[model samples]
Target: MFHRSVLVQKVLEFLLTADDGVYVDATIGDGGHTLAILNAAPKATVIGIDSDKSALETTKERLKFFGKRLELVHGDFENLDDIVLGQLGYGSVDGVLFDLGLRSVMVEDRFRGFSFKKPGPLDMRFNTDETLTAYDVVNRYSPEDLERILREYGDVRGARKIVEKIVDARKKTPITTTEQLAEIVVAGLPQRVHTDVLARVFQAIRIEVNREFEKLERGLYAALEILRPGGRLVVISYHSGEDRIVKHFMATESRDCICPPGLPVCRCGHKRQIKILTKKVVRPSQEEIKQNPRARSARLRAAEKL
Candidate 1:
């Protein structure tokens, strides 16, 4: 079974104040938050979007009790304007919830290659329709390209060594499975830091397979555009790379003049779009983290459109 959502109560409490509001659960993984949102406000309508078709079906099954109150769409949240706004005929949305990172079900599915602990196909595409996978990346990318991805996406310090080892191993025999690729990464790292290093390498490959960063870049802008003037944008990010972009957008979008600090007059009329609610990111409580270890790294930041 998939793990319970990380911050259900906190998210629900925020949306409760707005009655009969329209909400969007961008990464509606299995509809955990979608159910909560519906439960909180009976009049609220939720548009749940997920790129994984299987997960969307599973979500539909789980939320069948809600009937017409919930709408499930088999599409990426990145295309919010077309899939959500245009189709729904809404000028702006009331609340937006983005649960970033792989869901529990995705990680558990060995065929998805999201977890290194299991031996499965090296396919890490969240959409499943994507042509590239961890298998394609490992076997096709140049050593330099591999090193760059590991260092940038994975934040792996031994990226060069890991890339060299991956290239050498693939030349001898194709790295086809999660176990095989993970073993190669483990072997390349120092004996003491093998597990940590292996995880970083795997994460790097998964990020590349999904074009995760690019999606985030486009998605955040579209999300803001689709939100109403007083609407809220809630984002829960697991990694620093993802959090950096969210934090930057929240700050930049909320500013009146994005000009350099040394500017004498405010010439760039970049109006403040959103009001950042959390001065610092809100993390799960100690008790919550103790119950769900995965919640330990999750950080939540919210903003309201101006």
Candidate 2:
């Protein structure tokens, strides 16, 4: 089974409004958070979106109880505007939830190659239809491109050395599997380096293959644009990079002016779009983490549209 929803109670409390409304589960994975939302708001309708067909299938089975109340869409959340307008028509959705983390299904399915711990193909695409796979990245990318991805996406240490190893290994034979890539990364780094080095390298490759950061920025802006005034936008991010983007986006949108200091007059004319609800980022409780270790890294932030 996929991992349990992270920070469920908190998500429910912050995401649900007093009256019933439509909500969008931007990264509806296995529908865990979607299920929570539906349960919390009986009259609410949810439009669940995911890039992975397998995930959508599993979500369908799991959320079958909701029937017409839950509508599953096989698409990326980055196209939130198109999906929302196509399905529910224009204007107002009460809330949008973005849970930006790999579900257990992705990591546990060896064929998907999301986890280096499992030996599998070097295909780390969230959507199976994507042409660029980790195999292509590892075997075909130039050393400079490899280094750039490792540095910018994974923030991996010794990125240059890792890329050197990758270049040398592929010259001998194509790197076709997750294990092969992990071994190459490990072999290139000093033995003293933590095992996490391999994970970071894999993360970098996955991020590149999926274009996660680019999609995230687009999706967030779309979500904000689709929300009705006073509607809520909630996001649960698993890493510092993702959290930073969400934080800055919400902060920027919540402010009345983004003009540089000492601008003298209000020439920017930037009106506040949303109000930050959680003054501090909300974290999963120790009890929730103890129950589901994966929730340990979750940081949730919410804002209400103005």
Candidate 3:
């Protein structure tokens, strides 16, 4: 089943600045937020894009009632500029949303190998057509590279020890299953953090397999450029790393200058492009989290083009 959208009410309040407008649901997973947008703004049109064709198909079916108001595309948000240009021809969008969280349907599919609880091939590509997979990350990556991903992507402590265990296990037999990798991770980490570390390790590999951070950075820039003046950009991220990137981008873009404090004159000449709507990152209510536990980690930030 599709999990409920995170911070849907906040999204609508921040995003629906114009009664009739164009919006982009950059990671339109299962169409939860997109559905809400269409319902809230009767005349608004949404360009829903996702790397997963399966997700697009499901959203297309679910949103068919809206007819041409919803256009589902099988593509990554990293190329949002081109996709938006293709649709609008010569203009900008009123709002763009990036909800960087996996859909519940994808995680529940054992064949996709997204969940550690589901024992299946270690293939965690958001787009199955992509060449890289979690299996390659675990079995083929060097200890140093593995350690770097675990440290940077997962915020995993004792990443070297975890990498050592993975390297040792794969040496005997190729680490081929999500269960195998999770078991190794749980064994390598301390008892106190075993559960959390196991999940982070899996997350690190999946992020690497999908090149999530890199794509996210590119997508953010594209989204900002396509937004018209006063247009809103709302992003909901589920991990600290993703949240950090979004926060930094909004903070940097909202400032007029990026020069060092000690500098006498501003050399960067950076102009402020956006104004932050949320003074602080927004989190889901406890009641919402109770209904959908996956919404617990979500952090939402919104900005308007200046």
Candidate 4:
């Protein structure tokens, strides 16, 4: 069920204020927000970048009507600097948006192994070039390693039991498919627990396979660097971990001091770089969430460069 971006109106209202300057949709997943921005600023040029070639291709076809207004680039959000300065030949941008996390298409594609509801390949990589897959982690990771991923990434309550079951199952035969692994984890859990926990486990594997957190850290900072003074940076994250990174980055970027709280003097000389536009993270309205359950977890945060 592909749905429009959670905060389309809000994002467009903020970005469209800039009449003709360049705008970037960092995670241009399915071009949901991209379309909104393009419609809002018809004369403004947009650089839509996505790590998934398939996504860029689909977006290209979906947005074919936009013609020359949209410039679709195939690359990871982490390569924002290279794409912006090296390829586009721009030192600064007017606005940038990141609707982070897995897209609805990714979740819906059982072949991607992002959702536990259906069985598919244990491949969670966004880009096909990546060697690591969910299969590699599930079958090869040590028990402690599996436990760490489950505990840290999944936040699963029965991480120990689940990891033990995984290690035990892999010994008999390599866990080659999503069903094989999901069955192992499901069997390890109590019947009373909902399948949502299992979903988190899958999410953990996907995140590990793609190094999502690291990419987000690098990508957000890159956006900060590429943005022109007074340029707006809008980010929409779907999970707690992703949200925490955005929260911290926005807070610190808008802060003046990095010293300890007790220290009165400014020793670090950290100057504020951004002015936060949304103090409280904006969430999808109830109507939107009802229309698209996936949007339930979405949170939007915006800031302007100093």
Candidate 5:
């Protein structure tokens, strides 16, 4: 069971605007944060959206007691605007919470291939219907493209070596499983490299397979558009890449002018749309981290619409 909700107390404290308002859990996962919101604000209603059907099913069963107050939707958050407008129309939502950590249910499931510790098929698609999988990327992508993904997404130091090994191995036989890929990555690196090298390699492939970065960018903008003035947007991201995107988006939107530094005039016409609530990024407390180690990497930023 995906039972842990990281920073639950802080999320409720910062995210809820009123006792009764519409809230959207953009990545509801197993409804941990959604359930927290409902518990905090008894009169509030939540629109929970997730790409994985299995996640939605788990969330539904876990939160069934909430009754009609929770509306579970099966879709990617990238289409947040369409989902919100189609279901509830525009500009009325009070808060949107994005808990960006992948749930333990997904990681622990050997079939998902998210963890190198588990032996599984190289299928990391959040939505299983997606055509691209880790298997396809490892076997079909050109050496140049493979190196790029490893370097950009994983921040792997020896990306070229990893790609070279992958290309060489694939020539002999298709690298179809997580274990096989991990072995190749381990063999490519020098003996001094940390074991985490394998994990980084796998993570890069998973990110590309799911298009997480693109979806996150779209979802953040859409969340901003749907929030009414004074409404809140709270995001909790689990990695540096994701935290950087959320941080930059909030900083850019909260600034009045985004024109070139040397420009004498403001030609961009960009207006400050939201006010950043947390001057510094918030992290889970030591106690919280001790309880849930997964929360250690979480960086939370919040802003209110102007």
Candidate 6:
């Protein structure tokens, strides 16, 4: 499972605050990090939440030995406040860990259409029950809409060229699969940047299909409500967009007055709610990256509730 989860040690180091604390693994993919938390803090209880039911099921099996210490919830983290509050009321969470990376299992599953290397239908919904899918975005979006997500979500170079290829290819026949899209992306990009752009295109479409940015924003704000004083909120995000969201959230929440820069006095009366634990963004060490190359892009930020 991609070296059994990236930066598991870092997660435990930053997130576990108490032996019998109630923690929430907001994206408990395969229970890797959650398992690490349980082992590190023997008396801790974890309410693991994920949108993917299959992932929760896999985690359930892997962590069955922990019994009631593991409470696997089936839902999106965007509802984090309601979910956590329902379990422990207000301000009761000891720690919250948002490991915002795709699982290796999900990426490797050809049927999931997450990997450009895999030939599969463009169905990259984390929850199969969700209405939108990668196919909807690729085959149906206008050239402008396609380019918007490519630039806004993917931040890929040559987005216009990629959109042109997609629009033209879809006119011949609908862009139906991951392989087709990857080929179109490659054909549109310069050879030097082709592979990276191809990956970005898929990632952009997947992010759009899942509304990942929207949910992440909502989840970050809502999570602040459930953290007890001194409780930690640790986020590990792999994408730049995801990292930006976490970074801004932490910065905004940690500030006492959010008035305009030139304001003489504080008008926005926003009391600081959190203390930033990591002054700068924390990243995985070279040793960890050597063990799991995917860990290289992980940006971790932590804060404690005030």
**TM accuracy, model 2:** 0.96
Worst 10 residues of 4 by lDDT: 1-10
> Candidate 6: where is the Cα deviation over 4 Å?
1-3, 87-91, 188-190
lDDT of 5: 0.89
| Residue-by-residue lDDT tens digits, candidate 5, 51-103 | 88998999999999999999999898998988998766745699999988577
- Model 2 score (lDDT): 0.88
Query: Model 2, which residues run further than 4 Å from truth?
Result: 188-194
Task: Tell me which residue pairs clash in candidate 4.
Answer: none
For model 5, the run of ten residues with the poorest summed lDDT: 187-196
lDDT of 4: 0.86
Residue 253 local lDDT, model 4 = 82
Query: What is every candidate's alpha-carbon RMSD to the true fold?
Result: 1.4, 1.5, 1.4, 1.4, 1.3, 1.6
lDDT of 6 by residue, 60-136 (tens): 88899999999988999999998878754645789999988578889999999999988999999998889899999
**Per-prediction backbone clash count:** 0, 0, 0, 0, 0, 0
- lDDT for each of the candidates? 0.86, 0.88, 0.90, 0.86, 0.89, 0.88
Candidate 1 lDDT, 1-306, residue by residue in tens: 854798888788554447688899999988889898998888888999988898788888888998888888888877998877688777778988989888888888887788889989889999978688888899999888888999999999968877888888988999989898888788734689877887888888888998888898788888988988888889999999999999998989988899999989998989989999889898999999999999999998888888
Local lDDT at 190 for model 4: 69
Q: After superposition, how far is residue 98 of candidate 6 from its true place, in Å?
A: 0.4
Q: Supply the global lDDT for candidate 3.
A: 0.90
